[model samples]
Target: MKVAVHPDRRPSHEAEVIAFSYHRLALDLARHLGRDVNNWYCYAVWASKAVSENLDLSPGSCFLGDVAARLNVPVWLRRPFRRVFLALLGPSYPLALALANRAIFLEMGSLAAELWDADDDYLIRVDETGDFVRRPEFLSALLAPAEEEFLDAVVRLFTKARNATGPERAEFVLGANIALVAYEQQRAQRLLELVLNRPPRWLLQGSWRWLWCALRRRPFHRLAIYTAPHAELAWPARKAERWWVRFYTSRLMVMRTPVGRIQLGRPLPPPKGAAPETVWAPIQDLEVRELVDRFLPSDFDRATAGVGNWLSFDDRMRFIVAYFRMYANVPELFDPPFTSDKLDELEAEMDEGHVPEPYQEWLQKENARRAAAGRGVRGLIARQRYRSPFRSDPDAAALAGFDLTGCVHRRTLRPEAGPEALLCCGIDGELCGDAGGRCGRQA
Candidate 1:
């Protein structure tokens, strides 16, 4: 006779069930602590899993509980792994992992009371059964025999992962993990920009088969493809290159590059519900502590020492990868049907002092127009075409569209900010009888 398992009992990956399990234990803590449910780390855990496309472990919230119960794994088994992971990943994994860890721990505690002894330490066994699940007589006893060694292995694995692929791929993976766990909007936005601006180098070159493999089945890989490579360059360098390209395009008018200035959109403050003050997540700090302890092989506190504070390995690699991606994507922005042969022909023609037909026509037209206006042709050609936006350049093309004269005073700061300030500030000032304090501008 075949064993028949209930449909729900067969291990479901349904979002609702996973969410329920994650929120059940996680939200309970918030309630007991008189905290908001949304502020719990589990929310990030669930969100991270949802965003990941290549996770081998079930995205189910109860999966952690199952991993603990079936494998006799200790709740703290992940502690060492977390540090190594974060060290390799940099500051991005903590927020996601913390929430994930919380859910896992809650489920572990619920699954087996013996998992954690009265000493607030998890038990472990070397023989897989975890039969040696006993509290230490002394409070100072280390959790397990291989605890130290295992943490070392984690760091090694991260190193291996970095070596297997370039730093670009590793950063992408780590960034994706961090975004899942990030609590603050600023942090999330920063990660998102990094992910969007720079993709791993693996996605850009190598055999088509290899590129295909890297780009598929992973959320980070997918994002890498979307952002392309050249856009990943540092803002300043990329902006310079784009300005040159735009100037060339305007003169030649042969190629239409999508390469434009990095126009920063209007500043959007975090929403009221997304305030970081209320959502004081502590995963990043914990990961930092773990990494300093595990990798540095010294007694210095990572939190106090600030090991990953200024330009960690991952941080530096991230900018490099992003800028590389930006450079890599540059050639693709030109009109398609462009080939190496065509580029060669163009270069040869330039060397032979032969301007392209279109460019010649444009030059002639510009010369005639200048002559009619009584301006010398030599003067126009001698003018410097490129100008940096960072510096004060009067000749720089308008950053935005034409300015509206009628809306001059209102747009002193920003057009969008003006209306909102007028309405909200006006009402608040009137209600409190505080005219000077109301609105951004004086009433």
Candidate 2:
């Protein structure tokens, strides 16, 4: 019943008690599935990536959420299966919840992004006419008597968390379903510092989305969305930035997302009499997000050294090809083969040119030998590839959303805005992602 009693350093009375759906399944899998199932830190597992609109605190629910197939989804069989697991693993639920930390990193945004869409906003909206009502206004109308009071409470929560020790910081954060954090080198402190500073209209909607979309401006392109202190800053155009702030709905749970002197998503502020470009320059450094970038932030947030992956996954053949080869180069892997997006990376120095005559002859002989039998094609059919702990990220496309109109939020906002700098948003819980007069360019 009592799975993880907070760390011994902290008193148990102050800790939270909650439940997870498949706590037992996760625990059993971790214990029995593979002795080598990756070990991910609880902190990294708790962190989030973009697609902020719908985050819920459930077991194994990170950016790389549940990928294991659900074989039993029929209405009649669902309840019984759950009950059986519940009865089997009932007593050790806490152990499962406590150890259910690591999740695989698979995507940049929602994998079921289209399916995840639901009309949950009761306070804000952009009707067909193109006008918008932001969250603050909506919350203000609904929580009228308590809206201002809740805002004050949030400010106080931030203050309390700011003053707490590193271990206790999460206590203040989750109390309000907040993921308050800092930008690089303690640039901004807490999501509220910038969020509250801006008008609600701008807090929920910004002008950057439009600038990125309309003129193809680079807006906050390759910043680190998760905390990756261990990731090496080796990739090109990939500056080391460990700062983020995301707003989401967590059911009866608060995330341990806050750390000290950090700001979530808001850009840094220009100091008194300092050059304004210092702050603005970072925001404008838009570069493309690549597949290698996907491999950087892991669900474990570990160092990048040990995670060496040389061979490419021939999605077509469903096999591990030579480190240098790709589907285009491998002629033998044709005729209804498969490829994996796992190693969908772009190589710097390609593996081209001709194979040496001796090696080529050996490959032909091997192909002939395998072809005479009924095994398969070129590459080795990978039975057990490494299960590296990775953080789920949005696709390169989602990270590059503003430029291409990232989500329903941005896609809906574009046509509503004027051709010039002024921007607008038409989706509910969505704001005009435009720079509006800031860029001075209209549609």
Candidate 3:
């Protein structure tokens, strides 16, 4: 008999949110334990599966329960539960949610390892069994006794890759990271050496350069390399190098006039035509705009104009933080319109000080717009009508799009691909608020 392999199914939105909350908990655990673990993606997948298997509750439901438990609110509360809960927690919801979610994950302990080891197909199979009759047998086989040693080896390999420098260094680092998680240290090391000795045929293509750039610019780039080969370079020298790379990578725009690049502190004049409908649904509301304007400086436009047309990454983050800080107590302003995952991502970026400026600007605008419309902020990306490349169904085609890549739905999944094709698949789907069956994959 031929074993069938199905494409990995997308988790429901509630699963994504729960997974996200769990992921934050995992990150905290990793940091507190001083362990170098796999990325948030891995933790999230594990968390999603665990929640699905144990609770048989959607992520959203679990999140609400978690929140209620934290607030000492009864789960039996009905109708105005959310309203009353928000009123009780006020602006402290974010912090409270974080604590509650952390407590929930802490209850999992070593079982999280089993969830991480089990693949999606296996998890799905177990779930379909209803009572999870096959769980113990499958988990035993899935999680090897040597798993702890394997994790240690992975950290070691990453450390070694950090110190090693070659054309294939990045590839080796990525390969090693993946292999380590899969408990294949020898294969990971061989991959590193293979890249060092000979360039892969695919690397000859133009795509390799783009991949290299992406790898080098990643936030964790420095962590992958053990030693800085060019440690002697001064800060100014490093800054200049970064600027040149950015300039080379930036999309070039040709202008006829000899006008210099817009200086910091000057606002670009609004385009001549009607301002494109605000990208955010909330921004289009006159009332929200009025409210946002009130919080800003009297000469906000003029003062900000002096700063430049685009806000610096730090400034954009500051503005977002300021907005939330001011509106935290107002659920009408803070709660409904935004999803927990988006808010988590926003907070994460703020903590890391690497808020992607373009995405942040979109968030700020959308929050202001939502407030104006008497709606709470919902998700990181605003919902927009777009066609999913994966499905031909009219309804799926018209599903609201999320800006996962910060470029919106300029990309999508194909039928042959798995859920991994889309980085923001889980969170985006949840925030879109589509019912599970509505976005279900058609075989």
Best-to-worst ranking by lDDT: 3, 1, 2
Candidate 2, residue 82: Cα displacement in angstroms equals 22
Angstrom error of the Cα, residue 39, model 1: value is 4.5
For model 2, residues 65-117, the per-residue Cα lDDT tens digits are 31112233465554564555333322112111221110111111111121113
Evaluated at residue 391, the lDDT of candidate 2 is 12
Q: What's the alpha carbon RMSD for model 3?
A: 26.4
Per lDDT, the best of the predicted structures is 3
User: How displaced is residue 71 in candidate 3, in Å?
Assistant: 41
Task: Give each model's whole-structure lDDT.
Answer: 0.27, 0.21, 0.28
lDDT of 3 by residue, 248-360 (tens): 22321111111122222233223223132321113322322332332234343432333211112223222322222222222121111226666565345323322222111
Name the candidate, 1 or 2, with the larger lDDT value: 1
TM-score attained by model 1? 0.22
Any idea what lDDT model 1 has?
0.27
Report how far residue 261 has shifted in candidate 1, in Å.
26
| Estimated TM-score for each candidate | 0.22, 0.16, 0.19
Deviating ranges (above 4 Å) for candidate 2:
1-160, 164-171, 175-177, 180-427, 434-443
In terms of TM-score, the best-performing candidate is 1
